[model samples]
Target: MRETRTMRPRAAPNRLIAAAGLLTATMTTVATAQLLPGVPASPREKGPDELARMSLLPERVGIPVGGSAWVLVRLAIEPKWHVYWRNPGDSGVPVELKWTLPAGISAGEIRWPRPEVFRTPYEITYGYADEVGLLVELKASEEIGTGARSASIRGDWMICKEMCLIGGADRTFEIEVSGAVEADATDSDRVPITDSEAFAAIARWQAQVPVAPPEKMKLRQMVEFPNGFRADANENAGVLRLSGPAGRFSEVRFLPDATPGTTYPEGGPVEGRVASGRFEVEVPISVRPGDALGEALRAAGIVCLGNARTDPAFEIEVPIGPPTAGGSTAP
Candidate 1:
């Protein structure tokens, strides 16, 4: 067994935002020290028994001018060790990426695959074990000059089993951007690019990305208080009712978005119950004192179902209204 040591300055809370009526959360890990660009850290500094390995992988073929391509920041973890998800449930930090791109080039958000639930003696967390791929989309400006180009990425993550260790790496790779061929009178010119095994691996992980809930599922909001507004609003709690096709899900669990001072009930499970060929689960929400519930609270999370590795996980964002006289409102 590999020995691990505790690290200082725990992971920071995730930030939440509601844009265009859509609830989205950005996961970030605080860095104790930022490494300068182009400087690669020696992996040996962390010893050979490190829990995870990091690398950058680009598509096999060159990119076309004014076109976009995908790059993967791959993390291969040792057995029994795991890294965190965008929302690292009870504890843990999400992987952070810092990029050094050439002029006229940009990187998009990291597209995370659905993560597994990991329970510890003290708390439950969301993370991935074995291997995980973090995909990043790279785009080139239309005015980009055709030639050879390169970019560097710095990745930082926390790996843990019983103890935690912080690890990071800097990887730089070259990008080949080819000039666009002139189009013929009848057909549009298309860039020729061959797919590699790496591309196939990315495809597999992309399928695991959570998608919006299907039409059959209906989401609603409910509020509960001991004595309405007369009682302490801090005692007030929110609930989300998700009713969907029961047969499709043998079991379901909800992982709430990570926000400071906002949390789900400790040790409480959000398991789905089946009745009349439909499944329903109520997710509880608790807000700490001085934390505003806002006029419209958007509850964002993943709805995971079943035990099979291929089981489906749907992404859901339910907008909850303020406390009403009836203690509930339609979603």
Candidate 2:
């Protein structure tokens, strides 16, 4: 886990700042004109109308009755601008969605894609540039009758390049429900996406989503001290060491989940060393004094290896116990 501290907005470039100012001024003028006694206000626009293109897409085959499907909130960002992850790291805001579903329909949590680390002189943030697809699972109640169902989502997000701007869209999706209820849909059950294009797109993003760390990759052994934790005798703050098959990884880093009272260092690299198919590095995990430390501190985070596109990222949830007298190794 990284250290947690509040970050103030950094000043953007003069040209971009000026551009943003002008845009705001223009919008203000338009609003003022609409308020005038006899002036007619322009009709409101629907969908994304900003630096990013947004859409809500369903599988081409549409929704199935009494079964669940994936609905993607897709964002194709304009060049040079980016949007944030569920936890925006040190700065920026995460995407927000408000769903309007039919009485018998429900939506699941937003499945986030792995985020890239972006850095500026002022602050470091975690987000996606270019394009990203956030997936949500939609399930219809068993009693729901077959017919057409409408679902809508109102989304708000902040996009940033040299400066930041808020953007939003109102999008609705229509799906035709058919087929009888399945006897059981276990957690392991999955509906094979049939739309070639849509399936390909989803598969690309889904690969970026981290899964549980394989047993061989977990921090199964650790050395702790009175001051902090480390893989060796070195007294480094929030550091963990691991020796593994280095050949499998070109690089290794950790992207921690948002944990209160903890913060990570700015930028992408999680400091460590790899050599001759063996690796060892100290991972910094900071804990604030006086903050309630439970019986065991569980540090859950994503362990990413190799580059973003090629290799897969793994999730690890490890419990760090308090150091005993003379220090000891964590499980």
Best by TM-score: 1
Q: What does candidate 2's lDDT look like per residue over 162-266, in tens digits?
A: 767677777765654544423443421234343445556766777777766568754443434446443333223554444455567768766666654344455
Write down the lDDT that model 2 would get.
Answer: 0.60
- lDDT against the true structure, per candidate, is 0.62, 0.60
> Model 1 segments beyond 4 Å from truth?
1-49, 59-62, 179-195, 214-235, 288-297, 320-331
Error of 2 at 71 (Å): 2.1
Q: Quote model 2's TM-score.
A: 0.69
Error of 1 at 65 (Å): 4.1
In model 2, the Cα lDDT at residue 157 comes to 85
TM-score of 1: 0.71
In model 2, where is the ten-residue run with the lowest total lDDT? 25-34
lDDT of 2 at 265: 59
**lDDT (10s digit) by residue, model 1, range 1-331:** 0111112111111110111013211223233343334646675433212467775554232455565667777888888889999988777899889988889888898888888888878888888999898887777776777666656777888888877777776766665565543333111223222334545766777777776776656543333433332223454465666667756666777767664434566663477776777667777766443454343345667776776545777776655445566765445
